[model samples]
Target: MVRANRRLLRARYGRYEGGPDPLAAPVDLTEALDAIGEDVMAGSSPERAMREFLRRGGSDRAGLDDLARRVAERRRDLTRKHNLDGTLQQVKELLEKAVLAERKQLARDTEMDDGDRMLAEMQLDALPASPAAAVSELGAYDWKSSEARADFEKIKDLLGREMLDQRFAGMKDALENATDEDRAAITEMMTDLNALLDAHTRGEDTPEQFDEFMRKHGDYFPDNPTTIDELLDSLARRAAAAQRMRNSMSQEQRDELDALAQQAFGSPELMQSLSQLDGTLRALRPGENWGGSEQMDGEQGLGLGDGTGVFQDIAELDALSDQLSQSYEGSRMDDLDLDALSRQLGDEAAVDARTLQQLEKALRDSGTLKRGSDGQLKLTPKAMRQLGKALLRDVASRMSGRQGNRDLRQAGAAGERSGATREWAFGDTEAWDVTRTITNALTRTAGEGGDTTAGIRIEIGDVEVQETEARTQACVALLVDTSFSMAMDGRWVPMKRTALALHSLITSRFRGDDLQLIAFGRHAEVMDIEQLTGLDAQYDKGTNLHHALLLANRHFRKHPNAQPVLLVVTDGEPTSHLEASGDVFFSYPPHPVTVAVAVRELDNSMRLGAQTTFFRLGEDPGLARFIDSMAKRVGGTVVAPELDDLGAAVVSSYLSSRRSGGSGGAGEDFDGMFGRGWGRWG
Candidate 1:
């Protein structure tokens, strides 16, 4: 993959000029909105819902759930790798068996002097009970078993490398294989690296100085950083990890490792150069973690003598790097290893982090949601439209469960064509009825075909408007209950969806008609589709059906020449009434004044020839009884609907009403809607 990317870059730039990691792609609107809807329906506030939306790691690669599993796996891996209890037992058994074998071998060496044999026995007897102590003492002793000696030698090598390698990668390899010449070369690299850091710190370093340093010692760092700052950043992280490792180890372990680190390259000067480099890096990158603690699950047998320091360092670096670049914003995010992230954090979590970062980037790039002047993320107009369209599509899908092509001619302006061609009219909003209009134009043009009719064309007389069956335009008011109780019952999103669906249908399909939305709770207010969808459900002191009905009446009055259609969606009865002065009077146990006020408003609507339908939700007896009684008084339709089917029910009814030419009026069996609900709601 690296080779391919390199080739691609070379082709693009004429050289291998690498760049940063690409930001994540945008999440699908359907998925994002569905998650948002779920959170909102679960009673989260809009702000909380947005937070939840962002929290899910917007990518398909992983999520919070995946990350949690990875964290567990990491913990288990640490425990398994550093199992000090089991390792200590193994070391003790090996030590005892080796000592016994050595004593037996001494007895078989018959040519040995008696004094030498006694001395050998004394050395074997001197072996301590503690494995750590015995191993420490065995440095000068001759071992009977080469295997045991080899094992002990491996322990020393492991301990030595663990101490040095925490501060620097490949230190173990260098220590095991580096010759005197190589050690000298490492010392030179360290000295130059520190010099560069110091020069850079003093603001005396130039690109030339960086180039010179890299030219001389670039082989030390395989990442091949292009800039001085990049190299420093790389060094700083490792240096910090080493310091943290020192901090996490026991004092005794620290002391032992301090001695062991010196033996790494077999040169004191190499260690000293490294020591100076560490100081310079630390001073330059003070922001790195220098004081942090981690719980050692056991005596982690990282190195032979005191590998605890190395294990602790590894753990700390894992934690630090996990936070710094795990699909999050970073100065050099491309340096991250995503596969390693999945191994450490779990694939699910990795995917989540990746996707979340992508979502943020997508949001920023798309400009759909933005930080406003107040520094708060606010949805842009484009975002709102997209969200509304997404919601409309969902509602449309639900309504399409059973369908045929809808004849929208009833929704068009009413007229009967005399089967003639004419110029376009000012009020023709419907699509051109192509058959008759085109046929008429062609018939006229064919006879006029020559005489400035060089083309088979008629002039303005060629255009015509298609006529429709006569039907009056309807003035529709959709009143939605936006009370706290609606949210509590998980009916708020459905209500909003229904309103958006019906709004879209009317505005898009029946543009000649007047459509208004009124939201009623403790008070009532007029809201457009956008405002209504964003409206938060709060303050349940009242369900102001009176104010809502009054608004509907006002709409009817504005369109007195048209049919008046009213649709009310509610989960509760009116618990508040309007005062004569217009302040709301709220109560709980069915206030007579509130009910009267509400009923009187409905009567006014009825007087205006408004046809009403009450879509009731929930099973509260008081609500059911009151809505039933109210529907009866106003002679409106009553339909108690499942929340999921509310949009389909309402939309179908509106279409049916238009088709029936306002047939289900006062005293009509509105319950006979599509021959299904007249009995159910009645």
Candidate 2:
């Protein structure tokens, strides 16, 4: 009898004799955030920024036009200076060449020896005689050479500048005197001339064709530019300006400018080149002419002018008048009531205003607090509940489960049994025996049968069948690491997500299951799922895995039949603890005392028939090895999943364990989920 009693006791309690080891696997969280951060940032609304930009008179189009105008003015200035510089250099080179020619002529005139003449030729050649090089080296040229170059250069510059001045004068006079129609036509012609000249220098059109084309369409260029060389140089300068214009504005800015022009002029493309030219002329430096006045004698000047000269003069004046009119229009814009324009735009104003408001609302709604308000935006109960539901959804998406499969399966040890039968319900299995149903019906009706006829009375209540469902009670304590390291490394968010998901699953799907949440850092504390949402790490502290496990063991002691498990997610190994002196003891690699404390906790967990599973998030191999050693001692499991795969790996392990009847252990589940067999210890 004594031997039999000992055998029975061994069968009942032997599995609790040895404790399970603690396992640690590090989780990586940064990789997951990278995938979704960009999408979130871009979709964030831009309406507010746009509205602010417009309120500052930085409406895209206006800003662009302002930029374009500034760029054009600057380019014109630079081009003029550049042309002046080039002309001076060219003149210097021309002087050098002339001086050399004169030296040769003088040598020949004096009947100098052939040797002297040859020497003079060689000297000139050696002194950077190329026109291009001479100009570039203008500073080094002799004073006489420089002066001679300046003289020739001044003549060309004066001729060009004077022509520009005369053109402007003629345009101004014609605009003041010509008929409105003639003024308009002349403005159009001037615009065409500016565009043609601009296009020609940009290499968009051949110089000869452009000049001929301008003369044919408008009388402005009838003289064919007396010096083709000077004309080519001028064209080069204009081309530089045109290139500057192309580089000055971005596409978006240009589009906005175009829109602004359209609003002001009815047609954004209605610009008259002549009017623009007139504006350019008025903005030019003083003493410039447009008719080459200084270069021609009276007869030559008169001959230079065909019947077209008068027409050209009239056209130029008309363009200048139009330019002045446009300038006046621009000036008047400031006085015109913006309120009136606002009304004309109508719903656009309201939309813009509302968009601005929405932007402010969004900023306020963000988690940050306002200056004067309380530094808290309490989550409404509805949002809290939604958060819980979201967690469950996330977990469910990560876990694989049989959907709508209601077949009852036995899971845990059988308890006291009693049989009960009930009639078939809508969701009941169709496998109920017909014979049994009929027998039950007939038996029930036999006693009351005197009035029952044989027409076949089959009632819904007569259907009966026997079914059984196994009750698998599980007590799981989730030990979340709330260390400062976890928060700093961005492990906290996903950890919370996983915790919430697990809590939701237990509360909603397995309502009868025993669940506990414990947070451990420098110390261990029990917390509820509701409180977990606001869980934050505080102080530089150590993780007390031992304390958490010990507490979990104490909680699970009351559940004699329930299987117990401990899940710990941490980034660092245990580091600090309270000492007998009522002071905290700490270490970098975790002191021997910390390890002893943790080992004792594991021993206690084993003594209570509970398994501990660890999920680590740090990169320390030492921690992993320590976790493996603990798992060996306690017979639990260690999983080190990449941060991106943490959610899936966690859910997969749980599901696999559930399917394997819980006896296959956490190590088996880890292997099933990740395809790598986890090494098991004693």
Candidate 3:
């Protein structure tokens, strides 16, 4: 063998940082579809079902509600874990250190005048009890220790930076050891910001003015908003959070901070500029929560800048919680801010929310759900087929004696040989006849007079397989009770599932067969599988099996050549009958006329030679006795399976009747096939 060209591939590994993962698997919509389908079958609209599934989430993913809960928990923890008295405490510690160092310096100095030293001691001792008051009173005091003087100046610097930091983020670190130039620049920036806001309020602002202001003070705002609205949103949110932080403090603490504000930067100008900024932000963005307060109970303290940051976090969390709720009017999944969510709750939460959004979009975009002319979301026909196949698989798993029969029985697969041979076609899985194939090859060559002397070469035209008789086509009518009892006793979804499973089997495996879903409450009407699955429960006080049987007989008449297979799922006896006037007459305790009418209709069905089975649902003794009597009257079968097993029981009975060729004479054999302890009552 010739040597093949070889290529060597090298793989490199590194830490994964941000963005979508290239190795991530494609999103799976099966779990979402199943949940949505189940809810739709339970009488919820498609839109409502989709929303409920996203809210409740799946086995492996957190839902919208779970994210909202985490947000709420984070907010609660912030309030419970820290108090806001850090700045004042720092001021007191620094002031105490400065005074202690000065007193020691005064004692160690030998060249100082006696009267002056005494005066200094008296002035230091005369300092006010409050830290803010003491700092303000020492504004003019002379200090001997250089360290003490520097510390005193640092206290003033701390206050000034914190004061600015409350309004603007990162100000504390940015203004450390700030020069006179930094202070003047901050004041100038504030003046420009206020002027810009005032011009915007009067509708006199232009894009050029905003651009010029950002060019001068853009460093102040790390958010770097490009538009006026964006800048206002950011500034207004922080200002409101700061105000809320002040509101959350005790009255005494608020008063102390108010007094301390006058000492920030050793001047009143900074406070005045900040107050103006706050006023302008509140005026421009009036909808921000400016008056809210929270309770803090923990011992850890947060300084002014840090406390405001916490409050801002709380504000973001509140907004996120609302987004997750999806309860506001005109809200959509796209309304959720994934970037902000990722910032607050990490990447996993953002992933969950994004996944939910993608799932909803896929459900609509993939043709699984579509808007009808009626302006309501409805399941498409493709969706119905997929959902029905899923139900059929569930039914198949519950079925017995066919471990290898995973697929529904396809047409022409019933292994009853007709002892004849025919040319094979595509998709034919029947076994080939060895003798027939060789004889056909020889006969073809002899007829052509070309391959008799040489060995007979078998062409595709000479190939043949044994033919099997096709199964009889079935005309099946599935009558499901939609009366108040079926809804009240929790048999609605199972009824729909059974109907869907049977519908799927016939439409998918036996396309030649005819299946009609007939739902009867106070009256009978024919519905397709989609309509039946999404049908809402009714509180009508009637079973109306009389009308249902009347409809079933009419269906059998429509297909006279096909075998009739009738399957009835009900939870009550006949309480209603169709009248000659084309109306329904209903009664409660089994009216004699209603029973007679129902029995008369059953006789009509028997005369038409329909194979019948009754699937009674509840434990009502009267229902059991009536169903048993009815089954005996027509030589049919009665099965009372649990709600979960109802679909399997109904499908198995249908298959048994189908195998019996749908002849009423094969009732004994049909019962024998379904007599596997399937809760037969008659």
Candidate 4:
């Protein structure tokens, strides 16, 4: 291990020392899921949250706006590569001037006749009208300038083998620095490929056929597709890309391609073969996206007179564009083209894309969130517990607070243990002290060794159980106001945080605890553990605390032995109440009727012996007085906590309630939660 470490240290990084980072790790599912949850809680839809995750990646601050700028930079680079206006114009000028020069010389010839001059002028006039026609017409004409001939040769070369290479991969390599044998090799490969496709389309091909073809022509297909379907998919995409390239061109460009086909390799049959191959591919994978226009924006035009690489580049961009837009539910994010992304952006961006794919895969496979029967993603129970625990852990970490550190003891239980042993009782709830029970058996069987030497044995008389402290199971109703105001005022996420943190604490620490999430908005409704986590804020204006209280009573009655712990998180005063007719009555300035109905519900909660805690979010004086009066009337605690520390405050209050049974000096306990004075907020 030490030698391996030394070797690793000695390895040189080369040019990568200060270049783009290569140490890209996969995105952790927990972090991505938490970010998704946070964005959802902040009022973003699940789809929007997933897009945000893809764009911003693991960066905490980078948003969609930043991503837009980066994508624009990539578009600028692409524009530089694809801007081929200048070269096409040059091709037009070279052909036009060469033909005109030929006509001028023919007109100046001493032996020229009238009929011949008329014919020369007519052809010269037709030159600019059809550039491709003029170029083919002047193929046999001698050029006055050698530069024009050289330019035409370059254009012909680019149009010939390069275009063929677009349809058939690896044509450039085969045609490079070779003789007749190489050209014959490509011709043979094309014929076989076309034959294979035809056989497959007619339902006459076997897997062995594809395998044999790949074994012979594997270099042309670097994708190394394992199945016939995979090969077809690849071939179809390339063929579609080639077709779309033609579709994107202007009329003059199409004319040029047509004329190039006439002159390519001194063989018109090559174009016919490619056309046949394209038709076969289309029949196989007809669903491929073959339409779309991407604008390459730049101030100046580009010089792309080399080969058909620009066309290939645009085709690749189109393929990547389709891959990045994953729309279906639980789509495999691994299908994203990392190499294309790397080419468009930097290597660093490819790393980020890989990480995002990892995160998406992890989320799909984790089974924490599953698609419901209605095809909507809903969190499972396991997801709720996982997310809740994370939130609770964050709250606990923040509890160290301004004091730098503090010892946190497990809160006191309901009943104390006698710390004595007893013979097995028929109906005891106490935990058995395994060590003490074993020792009792050993003492009883001190001299009773048999075939199994020194094996201690005891009958029912010697079995003893130890007593530990009895725990209290509380029925908790976390009342989160899911009204528009909570969302507007940036209090929505904090409210969710408080709920998750408290739910996790109760479920994990107090095993028998019964926690129900009551989301109150226009009307109150009881949500299960998972529903509360993914619940979006409603656009309703009312805060119907009355309905929430009614449901709390039902839960308490159901769990008769459990203590009722009511925790209300809201940003506004009661704006609505439940009417006797089962309707929700909304009011602005707190109607006397609404206030009366709310107070009546509070009275009912007090009668049921609920240990209430009102967490006021906003600092409106009217709202503060309302919560204060309600807390005083119920003999409960009122905490007006800052949004960030709300979770910590609620958790501290619950722990204190467990220790003191919701009585004694609770104010000091909440103050110590943040290691600061909470008397001011109150």
Best by lDDT: 3
What digit string (tens of lDDT, one per residue) describes model 3 on residues 1-682?
A: 1233232234456746666566767678788877888899999999888888889988898888899888999889999999998898898899999999999999999999999999999999999898878988888889999989989998889999998888888999999999999988988998899899999999999999999999999999998999999999988888898999999999988988888888888879888888988988888888999999999878889889989999999988988988888889767788888888988889889889888887777888999999999988999888888888888888867763333332334324344787877775444567787888888899988998776778899987778878765478788899999999888988889999899889988888767779988999999899988889999989989989889989899999999988888889999998999999999999989899999999998888888878888998988898899999998999888888888888888887777677678544433343343233433422
Tell me the tens digit of each residue's lDDT in model 4 across 6-74. 999999755444532467454466776777777766667555676667667665433333434555556
List TM-scores for all candidates, in order.
0.73, 0.39, 0.87, 0.66
Clashes of 1: 17
Query: lDDT by residue for model 1 over 1-682, one digit each (tens)?
Result: 9999999877743422243234434466556655654454345644455556654544454444445455556655665456333334545566676677677778887887899889878877877665666766776787766755655565554444544565557666666744557656766777778788889889999999899988998776777889998998877776665665456556755554565444443355656766778888878888977676444555445433233334444554366355543445433223445555655555554455555555556655585656767765555656655555665666555544333322222233334443443344433444465665566666776665634335445344555655454366888899989877887888887888788778767766677788899999988999987677667767566798889988889999998798888899998888876788978888987688888888888999989887788888988887888888887887777778788878866776666555455665532422222232223322
RMSD of each: 8.5, 25.8, 7.0, 11.2
Cα shift from native, residue 393, model 3 (Å):
1.0
Q: If both were scored by lDDT, which would come out higher, candidate 1 or candidate 4?
A: 4
Report the lDDT of model 2 for residue 627.
83
The 10-residue segment of model 3 with minimum total lDDT is 1-10
For this target, which candidate reaches the highest TM-score against the unseen true structure?
3
Q: Rate the local accuracy (lDDT) of all candidates.
A: 0.65, 0.49, 0.85, 0.69
Ranking of predictions according to lDDT: 3, 4, 1, 2
Which is the better candidate, 3 or 4, if ranked by TM-score? 3
Query: Model 2's lDDT to the true fold?
Result: 0.49
Candidate 4 ranges with C-alpha deviation above 4 Å: 1-27, 39-55, 60-76, 83-163, 169-307, 328-330, 338-351, 404-490, 512-527, 534-536, 539-566, 571-612, 668-680
Q: Which pairs clash in the backbone of model 3?
A: none
